[model samples]
Target: MVVRDAKPDEQTVTSLAAAAGTAPSMFNAQPWRFRYLRDAATFQLRAALDRTLPHTDPHGRALHLGCGAALFNLRVAAAHAGWEPVVTLLPDPYDPRLLATVRLAPADAPDQELARLHPTLTRRHSSRVPFRDELVPEPVRARLRAAAEREGGQLHFPSIWHVRAILELVRDAEGRDRATPARAEERERWTRTPEEARTATDGVVEQVLGPYGGYHSIPVRDLAGRHSAFEQGDPTPFEEEPQLALLGTAEDRPADWLRAGQAMERVLLLCTEYGLSTGLTTQVLEWSELRWPVRDPESGMGQVQMVIRLGYGPPVPGSPRRPVGQILEID
Candidate 1:
């Protein structure tokens, strides 16, 4: 068996880090850090606790999900660059914040499946605008389900009744947020002002918030709280049946959350490659009491990691990312 060299070049590391940095996170918080071990040829993903959304993501499950997505991107980037990535989730139990370690080694054959997704990494952004009522073709839906399954998770398109329950739970969570000043304050920390949005490297910007969903029926999360500058658009009814999917796993541990995150990104990238716009709502799942009913009662899906909306719609602008240098530490 052949082993790869212990060190990768600076340019290679920088490129991979940049690609990994593109993965989506809660409220665009981008709560992750990468450290490349030159001697070991491994890239470590660590949680940036300072960036955590304490009130919204109290248990850090969302943060783990975001980091897991970043880890998958690193794998794709390495594959595209003609290397094989061997990833280990939660590599250090002693340090819970260390989410993953990916060893990039020279490969006899690059991972074509992963390399194929590299191009779509930057193209996939959360679209908060309304999606057309058109149905996502059955074949396309099958492909997305396969994408999640490939990463060891299940993606279920909930039945209409389940969808209604999920939506109502979201409404309840939103109502709770309205009553909880701390939750709103936590959200504001990651939401950029118009001026900040123009230059900030992180957080959800005002422009990308889309016009206020004039109707509460829309599934899009209102990032622009009461203080937003954008005026509400005309009150239009959202589609009676929006294309929604719940990404889940058999368990709800940190390792499971990490796997769920990778699955979520794989599904998102596949959707983007097929020209689908996506939005996410984890509001319901954020609350333990509301999370259980979101699951399909018959499917045996234990935990729902994310609530995703997919359809044909105008693309939303990409959020800013911290510089690669700032996110990557060489050791």
Candidate 2:
């Protein structure tokens, strides 16, 4: 649908922000704000610090990535609306709050790719359960990698040994968090019981909780009670065989994180289109101690930005998203 008539208006900003909300955050934090100048038809976005994950993402790297993902969505929506989005990343060094500025440029119709991927935004939810034994074909892998590259990141599927090392890193991180006192407090604060009052506009929820009592390769971020009925069956062989893809960038920066976020969303949306379920795990990368070594020396792949698991499985139920009106303000 067209977001603007003769020129950019409130509708353009509203539609773009709603579309952008589909981009994933580290914890689905959806931390961002958009300001539209009607006369200039310029859309400006900034990171919403209140949604920042201070405990896990102190550097604001993930926050920027989340915002960047939203920015990418804005571009796509603009294209779908027959406009090319002109974006300036981190446009003003003095005003770091200005993450990006996008002005719509006139364009023809949106292509089939945009049309196909558009619907997946609302349909795409994180799947935390172990995927069925459906092997992802190399062609599918190549397409996912292409999706990442389109938004300026690289997707790498690890070799067997590399996958083993990555799994070990994840296990070590999970074990460390399970023991730390701060981890307990953080989890308690962010994870709501099925009946608990919801917090702010962010975080994983009980519905996205992985099955309990298992060593799954792509474990869900535990949000449910230890004994909740939502938990999956006993840890089966599928636990060791989850599909994994490593997302990376040549250089790491705020802009790079933003690119990675967009790439991430693209990959996830493409997965949804392909009838593949998907989830993300950044636990190991969340700890700086564990992230650096993820770069492979032999292949020259840079440090990993996101670790995603994908396969055919049931889709997770929809989670909460603040109303479009709530996420937008017009002046």
Candidate 3:
């Protein structure tokens, strides 16, 4: 059997890291790190304990999900680079921080489908602005479900009363956060001011924060609400009718969260490929009470991991990523 070289060159490593680094995280915390073993052509994904948002992601499930998204991007990057990526999740039983490992082997026939998604990596960003209230077609939704299912997760589109329940739960979560000073502090910690955003490497900045409601009741998380201490955005009208999808997995475990994260990213990327804008909110899911009811009583979707908004909308700037040098170690 032919084998790949023991070590990939600097350019290849940087390119792959750049793609993987584009994955979305809770509040853009980017709670993940990477280590490439040059001698073995393996990339190890580890949790960035320093970057964890403890209050919102108390159990590190969101962190694992973000890391899984990064892992998915890494796989796509590898396939585009003519390498076969063999991945193992939770390879180490004792080391909880070590999330996954990917071994890259040279591929004579690379994954064409994954390679097609290479361009979408840069194009896929969370659209925080208002999307047209038009419903996504059933066929398009089916394709999105296929994307999620391929990654060991499920996606369901909920309209009518289901949408009302979700929106109310999000408002409830918002009210709960407002009542508690500590919960409000979570948004403050990850939100960036206009000045900070100009040079900041991470966090939800002013431009993408969208704005507070004026005439609409969308469920977009307002990260910059506490302007007395941080920058706050002006009020803007959002779509009255938002198309929503619930992405979930069969089980609720670290591994399941990771799978949901991958499925989430895959669905978003596929959405981008179809020229659709997407945004995601986990606000209700952070609170257990609101989280349980997020499931559709009409259908069995396991544990609802993420609430995703999809539609046609104007593009927003992608959040900045930490320099590859900061998150990647080659040795």
Candidate 4:
């Protein structure tokens, strides 16, 4: 591969990082770092351990998926910036921590399709609010499923019974984790107070937490109410039934997690592109007991990595991101 010094405009760099910022994470915890090599027109992704949500993501599978989503964003940005992103996932297996090293290769040109997704990068957020009861047509879901498949994953739209089953798993997992002293301590450390300046890196804050309500179908682990120190939004009953889909992979491995993350982002981006809102729940997948059993009996997938809820609703308030300076290092 060709390697040489390259320079992009200020707007390009800012926009590129902005795209990466849109990547979804466990509880909106964007725990990933980006290193751009200006000379080589490449972006290197690494898992930022300090930002990790250990209480929720113990094995780093979710961590890798979050980084993978950011990596996918960088690729889309590269393509939109008129270059082909030649990615080497886990380029140095001996240095297993290196999530990906992406080199941008010259391409014919970028088209509208590539440039189109750039806006959605920042617009995409995990919407937890109840969706309008309106159903997402089969054709729209088919398009989304195809989008996931393009990135080596499949999206399974769950039926009513399946949705209820997965919902119970989420509730069980949340209750089990929340009851722990160690997990509660971690939650306190990351959750912020209103007096504090909005942090670029941390857990879900008041603004990002959508309309508050008792845990219902997509059981939200009560982050604020449990603390007893904070007040929550007015209770809105879980009246709307959301369109739920299972984001699954055929294999269960570190590399597969990375691919699943990319697929998750692609699906989310497509949703944004289609003017649909989405909320992501991995509580069931995070708990080992619920993961394998939650997989659709017919899909024959090895694991369910993420449960995505999508429909029409208010957009989730954008969460803060660590400044590029804080997340990057120069070699």
Candidate 5:
């Protein structure tokens, strides 16, 4: 496919790809690859088939979601660099791994809206630590909801009852994961031991996983694997009243997952910009039986893409990312 777009410099291309690589993914799986067409000036985003979390993310939905977040970052970075990025998703049915393509053209003017988010791309980290028990103001909540809508998604702050139900679902899934043979295999596959984390560039490293027990029915995924929900360290008290937001799309499909991923990162970056700490609660969302119940029955929202925890807290280290040379290629 050809478009009236200009090719970016090699240095600029790498910088943009670096920003894209920072987008959050399931388990920090970072299941995305990039190919820059030197002659055509187009970039292709692909799903690294090997990085799939088979047990937790069957059907490659999480792969698409993670790649979608990376696509969003690529756009933001391109915009910041005074180039307009043209994107095409799933361009070839025959090439299922090809998630998207980005072509950059010099912009007549800067996209300030997207450009403003550039600083936040690297600033956002998935904080697994305990957040202070404080309520997010209504104005801030409204801004987050709007951010989701801008990218074809909805963000709903659940009622107290709904929050309780979702938490229960997460606990149920974690219990099953502990007992299921395949789940154990998958968990062990991504979890790096404390000693192993120093060198490993991906997966849930021991450094980022905070602790074992927590209070208030918090739905944080127990990545502290020692054969249980949480078996690593002392109990860490989360917020007494945890604030939860569900990001959803109107439909459930590969394309919808991509949009939702973009929306999820947009929300996360905004949260970072607003000086708020956040963590993802996908334990319930990962399981099909539990994911649907996460939606508030009263709400008209569609498929729940992600569940986000928002509040004030210490910004803990996030999972490591693969090297750019490993994930991106220039042709």
Candidate 6:
């Protein structure tokens, strides 16, 4: 119920789109596009189907999650820029690719909560390295859970047995990928070569791949697989009881995935603010057979969206992002 003024300037649109593009994606595919409707003062979010992983994400659920994360970043950027974002998810059913339309309206009072997170936006990066054994404190865990709840999602800390089971499933997934090389096509496509890693605008690179978990069994996804010649430096054992959390929604629909993505980013930002390093493991969740068992049997919250690992660890370099001009279109 908010009215828009004249079209937003090109600079403002570009800045917002650029900030939105910083959100993380599976394998750094960044499969999302933005279009600024000058006349309507709205920014449209659409899935970049060409950048999607057909083998791993056939139904485009992961793609939607990535786009939703970008949408959240857009909202935060708009608030930081002193504008209120009025969002409409799946705005047009006839156009399924159109994920959202955000109208930038003048705000009587800007959202301070969202604006405060701007500083942490660029600081948050996925750490593939080993995390210390130290546990995340109760107070910080409470805050993370609250952050997820605010975004219409639930974050659950799995039991020891559940963690072991999840790790086993992840190992199974890795073994399957090794055996079925065809399934790795999408992964290989998104992982850059050494030379390309240095200059490429998108995709995960060798430097961020971290040391291989030779003896230790941390649930970190091995982006390097068997192709990279990069040596594993200072192989140290990861934490024995690594802290893990499960992000889930009440429902398993596209809209719910969007909410889960927003929640995931919120929790991640909060964790970053608390000096916690984070990593994600979605290999088990990628397959339906292994995904069901990931949920906490007691909680009855079965729709798992992401598995988060958090601890104190070394800083990870931020991945490159596509230029704002490449992602944003003005109409």
Tens-place lDDT per residue, model 5, 1-331, is: 3234566789999999999999888778789889999887789998888889888888787788889899999999999998888888889999888888888876787678888999998889888777887889999999999999999999999998888788888778778777778877887788888888888888888778776654336677777554333543446677667799999999999999999999998899999999999988877877788888889977799889888999999867767888899988999
Candidate 1: residue 263 Cα off by (Å): 0.2
Residue 96, model 1: lDDT of: 96
Tens-digit lDDT track of model 1 for 1-331: 4465645699999999999999999988899999999888899999999899888999999999999899999999999998889998887889998898999888989999999999999999988887888999989999999999999999999888878877878878777776788988888888888888778999999778876655365577767674232455455456677889999999999999999999999999999999999988888888899888888887778889999999999878888989998899998
Candidate 3, residue 289: lDDT:
90
The sequence of per-residue lDDT tens digits that candidate 3 reaches over residues 1-331 is 5465644677898899889999999899998899998888999999999999878889988898899999999999999998899999999999999999998888879898888899999989998888887878899999999999999999999867889889988888877777777767887888888888899888988787775663234678767664232243455668877889999998999999999999999998999999999998888999999999999966588899999999999988889789999999988
Candidate with the greatest TM-score versus the true structure: 1
lDDT by residue (tens digit), candidate 2, 1-331: 5445457656667887799877777667778888777777778887887777777778888788778778877777777766768888888999988899987765556545655677777888887776787789999999999999888899988776777777778877776666666765666676656665365355667767656645543445544434332465454345456668888888888888878888888888898889999888877887888897666666566657888888889767765676777666665
TM-score of each: 0.95, 0.89, 0.95, 0.90, 0.95, 0.95
Q: List the global CA lDDT of all models.
A: 0.87, 0.75, 0.87, 0.76, 0.84, 0.86
Candidate 4 C-alpha lDDT tens digits along 97-167: 78998776766665456567877888888776777888888999998999889889989997778778877
lDDT of 1: 0.87
For TM-score, candidate 2 versus 4, the one ahead is 4
* Worst 10-residue lDDT window, candidate 3: 226-235
Superposition-based RMSD of candidate 6 using all C-alpha atoms, in angstroms: 2.4
- Please provide, for model 6 over 157-239, each residue's C-alpha lDDT reduced to its tens digit, 9 standing for 90 to 100: 88888888888888887777666676677788899999897789999988788877763456888777742334655465777
Per-structure clash totals for the candidates:
0, 1, 0, 0, 0, 0
Distance from true position, residue 14, model 2, in Å?
Answer: 1.5
